[model samples]
Target: MENHDAAALLEQAAQLDAGDPLARYRGLFIGTDTALSYLDGNSLGRPLKRTQRDISTFIGEGWGGWLIRGWDEEWLDLPQTIGDQLGRAVLGAAPGQTVIADSTTVVLYKLIRAALATVSDPARTEIVLDTDNFPTDRYLVEGIAREEGLTLRWIEADPASGVTVEQVRHATGPATAVVLLSHVAYRSGFLADLPGITEVAHSAGALVVWDLCHSAGSVELDLDGANVDFAAGCTYKYLNGGPGSPAFAYVNRRHLSGLKQPIWGWMGRKDAFEMAAGYEPAPGIRSFLSGTPAIFGMLAMRGTLDLIEEAGMAAIREKSLKLTAFAVQLFEAWLEPAGVELASPRDPELRGSHITLDHPAFRNVTAALWEQDVIPDFRAPHGIRVGLSPLSTSFAELFRGMAAIRDQLRR
Candidate 1:
């Protein structure tokens, strides 16, 4: 709030940026050279320099040259091949369990249906869900329950925090067929306990489906270790995939054969080209595919996944913690005094790679901030979500963005 305080914080940011081992990665992005303080990487990540070259190469050598033979050669299995890479680099899943296909909503729908189908008991007719989940997750479940004559058991979650293991335990019972939840809260950046929740759901004889939009690349996941039933996420965020990139779905290998997702398509048949009479699902993860792969959308994320593999998820998570922590420090020193309230968790362990700050004035302040080239997304009811992507976001960039927020709040 004061000049001296601002000066001190600026110096601290400079020191952190200077010492940041991941700092060099900022150069790989397209728009980092400008004065823009891109504080929205949690929403959509910046494109990589390699993405352009990769797309070009695909056009020239892979798609442009190979023609439709591309399907026979590689495109037929592109989803699983890249899905395997994504699993190895980010999802903590083994091969044959993850597939890249469809929009996140479509994938979520398929997985949720599949999970519900696995429950044969006539008494298990309710779906357990949370209040604070993303709109799509809630909407999809609501529609599915309506169509299937299933009841919805809602978990009331605090916007400041997230669903606790205790809440999940209380929410599940004999009636619960499946429990759907977000690994990280979309509004608050609160990280949920995956293993604990999954264990609880299993005890209740319910399958678990995790929404990983905010969890995929920001946090280290152990879907296999947790014995998770199903998971899906968008690649556009910390995974740095371009806009509208295909989402990925992970089904526990144990469920590969028995689980039958509701949607069926020609591509998912045992032999896609067979044009067979009755549909026999493809073996393993490939059965999840409902249509042709989005070759262009998948290209950008490959570069980021390569970077994630090279840097390792552990180091990325460590940097993420530091980045979010540093953003909290700035929020306290500058924004809090300007009447900005921290909407996310105070404890780093409970948080993800981003934090939200709320103020009555933020709705309009967001427009002013964006005009100044300090772009953080505005959530409903006056919340500014500051998403810090560890690879492309610098401490100094965060400081600049926070300073701009403080200035706008003051204005």
Candidate 2:
């Protein structure tokens, strides 16, 4: 019976991979040919094979040859250039409103502060957010509230799901300045209703800022249609830009006028070459810039963004849904019998590109799984996140990883 079950799963994975439209893309990444099962792409994606060649070329030409002149020739506009591409491809945004720079934390801080600055009503002194948001988001809001003498309105969220529109409506009021949220919950892989939540916040006379870390490439984002006020997310995960890659920020075009990001540096000056005294901010999204852009960090994602634009977000989202559904299928068939609880949403529409499983033994099982080359990430309190990146991950890899998890659990 066990052998038959294994054969059935292998057949299911093969059929899924055979019918997959994006399956052709699996081999484009760094190690698709290997037996290494990487189920943690939502935490850190596999690097693109082309990134190596691009880096080699940039080192010999842009850095080695152009030197300081590279700033004048290309580096100055690199942030907005890449930002425009990212906006068009993955963010569902138009040009000139998005800029790529800074860490996601810094970008979130700048946008949150900017949102607060735009509020004219003195009574609107409270920043509303959920308890289950990423730590950086909650921490920034807490510190900012302290700094500006504001109040925090908390929305109690479930670890099994995420923030909902009804919860936002209940938590927000006349005193709410802005609502901070994550588009996709990191732990449970729950995708929040971005447009509905934004509408709720707007109805309460509040702007919305979203953390897009888990949804940028894994799910389809229509930021413009959602009427999002501000947003930030890292590139290292689904964007495949390597570790510590520069993050991107978006501001609605209407908000760009008289908008000032808190961080002001010489590079953000209207005429950075002027070198003259008082810091006059640059025009448009360029003003969001604080210091020199990390050219090296930005290089890898350009290739990935090109791939995203080529494959299109709709197709990517389709494959992501399939991957996670396959994951849940195997989880129920194998891990559920072993006392592993599915920590993520069961519905495909409500889920992001990943899923989590909870078992008391997972606290130690994760390290063991890693030693055997079956890679998934561990969250706090014995939750193992199975992050399936659609572009870089294949159904076969997912099956292998799931089988390994079951084997580990049985021991």
Candidate 3:
């Protein structure tokens, strides 16, 4: 923990980063406008240069020139096209099982409602979700529970450790129709044991729906291998999709035939333009789409997805671990004695790409850091989240941010 040891550790980290196969991807993003150390990719990712150009081209040609005709050309396929890329790159889903659609909240609502309907037994009327789930997810579930006259079985999760397979098992019973959780916890950055959790849920005859908002781009996900029943995630986070970009939903091919999304909009119907008298949902993931696709938002996501595919999740994950490890090392060496406790798991295998630290004045400290242009997020009751997007953050940036935090705390 001495200065010499910290320096040496940082030096070794820099060497590893330099030799990393994914190092070059850091340049693919707009890192900063004025040397800003952005440690908030878990909240919102840096915009890609390609996204700017792609938007410009789409605006000028696709929308400006082609106008409404663009729909007939390829505008209609945006959901399926981008959804397939998402499946191939991160979701571990087959092509037809994913589709770009509404926000994460909307997708969660649709999937949860659909799962509720599939459970015909009135006795199985409880929806299981962790108390530590993201606010939006919890809100959506609460709304669904109210609408369906179902009770919610909320599992109390350890703020630092997040939900575990055992916690889920204890919460899920024969009367549980669904088990919902975030793949990587939002505040703690804890990576849940997906396969094990899925097994537990399935054993109790409950369908599992994962909110992959944190893990999709920061971690390697094999939804198909895990036999996930359904999943949803926002692209604007680690995926580098621009702000408010359309989120995605995954419906396993097996479930597509059996589970029906609640929203039966014409866009999700087999023949969307047929103006049919009744709603006959489309097959596969396309049925998850509820309304007209956001052309501009999908274009922004396309650029980021291209970059993600090029860098590859394997390489991205490698750099992500390195970045987070570097930050944790710095905190232990410099800030631990000052009462700063690591809230994230020490073992990288149990964590995602971000690190969280606990301090009494976390909200104030985070705000102050932002004033100095060091951006990390704060969760209530004192946790500072430093998210390192492998494609945009650097070891040097992390070192500088930690140093700033240490210096500020000393004052």
Best by TM-score: 2
Looking at model 3, residue 184 earns an lDDT score of 93
- What would the per-residue lDDT of candidate 1 be over residues 119-235, giving only the tens digit for each residue? 889999999999999999999999999999999999999998999999999999999899999999999999999999999999999999999999899899999999999999999
Give the per-residue lDDT digits (tens) of candidate 2, residues 63-117.
9989999998998899999999999999999999999899999999999999999
**Candidate 2 pairs with clashing backbones:** none
> TM per model?
0.98, 0.99, 0.96
Q: On residues 1-411, what C-alpha lDDT tens digit does candidate 3 reach at each position? A: 467876886687678767877667667676554568888899999888777787788889989989999999998988998899999998787789898999999999998888887887778989999888899989998988888788999999887878999998899998999989999999899999999999999999999999999999889989899999989999999887788988999988888888678887879898889897988888777888889998787877777678778888898888888888888888888889899999989998889989899999777878888999998888888988999988778787787788778877776
Q: Pick the candidate with the highest lDDT.
A: 2
Residue pairs with backbone atoms closer than 3 Å in model 3 (clashes)? none
- When summed lDDT is taken over every stretch of 10 residues in candidate 3, the lowest stretch is 25-34
- Let me know the TM-score candidate 2 reaches against the reference structure: 0.99
Off by over 4 Å in 3: 1-10, 32-34
Rank the models by TM-score, top first: 2, 1, 3
Clashing pairs in 1: none
